[model samples]
Target: DAMVIQNPRYQVTQFGKPVTLSCSQTLNHNVMYWYQQKSSQAPKLLFHYYDKDFNNEADTPDNFQSRRPNTSFCFLDIRSPGLGDAAMYLCATSRDVTAQYNEQFFGPGTRLTVL
Candidate 1:
């Protein structure tokens, strides 16, 4: 099946330590997005890659960083994990942006645990 894949469904990291979560897709979509979803709150868009152009949300914290080596893969790098940072990291992909809209497929999120 050609779909988005997130590795290390569960991750445990010490406070202030760096952790990297990876996402890859076989869909070959042009746009890939990363979202941080906490317990009850709405998912927050952290960043995205539209082809080679990188877009980061204005309110995204400095602790969140992302890298896309190519069209099929992206990585979210957390510089310093905190207790408050423990949440589900979701990866999604879309073909292109349009005035009307297009659907994005999301992966089974990676759950991060901070200790």
Candidate 2:
């Protein structure tokens, strides 16, 4: 009965090391998103794939990247796990039916810890 799943709810990585967080949804939605959220801060949109149309937020750092090879799956790859990259990585999904307004359903999130 898992609608959305994220592997390794908590992850630890050394500084400058690469880490990848995964997310999958059973909802079969067409739109998938990745967001980064720090303590007491709003979740910032990193990027999203709207049925293969990749849309990235202008302020997203170059060290952060994401990929959606197919529906129901998405991955966030951190090129370098710096101290600043330690945060909660949240994955969300929404239907592509109505572009005007669509609410996103979030996963449990993977908390990345950089040492």
Candidate 3:
């Protein structure tokens, strides 16, 4: 199954607090990605780990960070979530080798609410 899974489909985070979101995949893919999306807008790539290589999008904020210690799991850390950070956090996975032609699989997403 080429499925990417994210836990806690909904999360309520406080302003200026830290939150971590998790993702796991059964696709055995070599790359995992984190994205931030808001109100039906296009998902913005935050970062991705292609095996041990970490690629961060050029415009990603410093407040966002990520880690992938193993092949199947990855974590997204948002430090001091602001009101602007109140959005859906999407976890995605793709095969590193076929990335040019293959599309990434996305999770159901964790909807973060900052208050």
**Winning candidate number (lDDT):** 1
Model 3, residue 79: what's the lDDT? Answer: 88
lDDT of 2 at 44: 90
lDDT of 2 by residue, 1-115 (tens): 7588998799999999999999999988888999899996999999999988889999988998888888988999999888999999999998874866477889999999999
Give the Å shift of residue 2 in candidate 2.
Answer: 5.4
lDDT of 2 at 72: 81
lDDT per residue as tens, model 1, 7-64: 9899999999999999999998899999999996898999999998999999989999
How good is model 3 by TM-score?
0.93
For model 2, the superposed segments whose C-alpha errors exceed 4 Å read 97-101
List residue ranges in candidate 3 displaced over 4 A. Answer: 97-101
Candidate 3 lDDT over residue span 1-115, tens digit each:
5688999899998999899999999998888989889999999888889897899999999999898989999999998899999999999888874749357889999999999
TM-score-superior candidate, 1 or 3: 1
Clashes of each: 0, 0, 0
Worst 10 residues of 3 by lDDT: 94-103
lDDT of 2: 0.90
Instruction: Give Cα distance to truth, residue 13, candidate 2, Å.
Output: 0.3
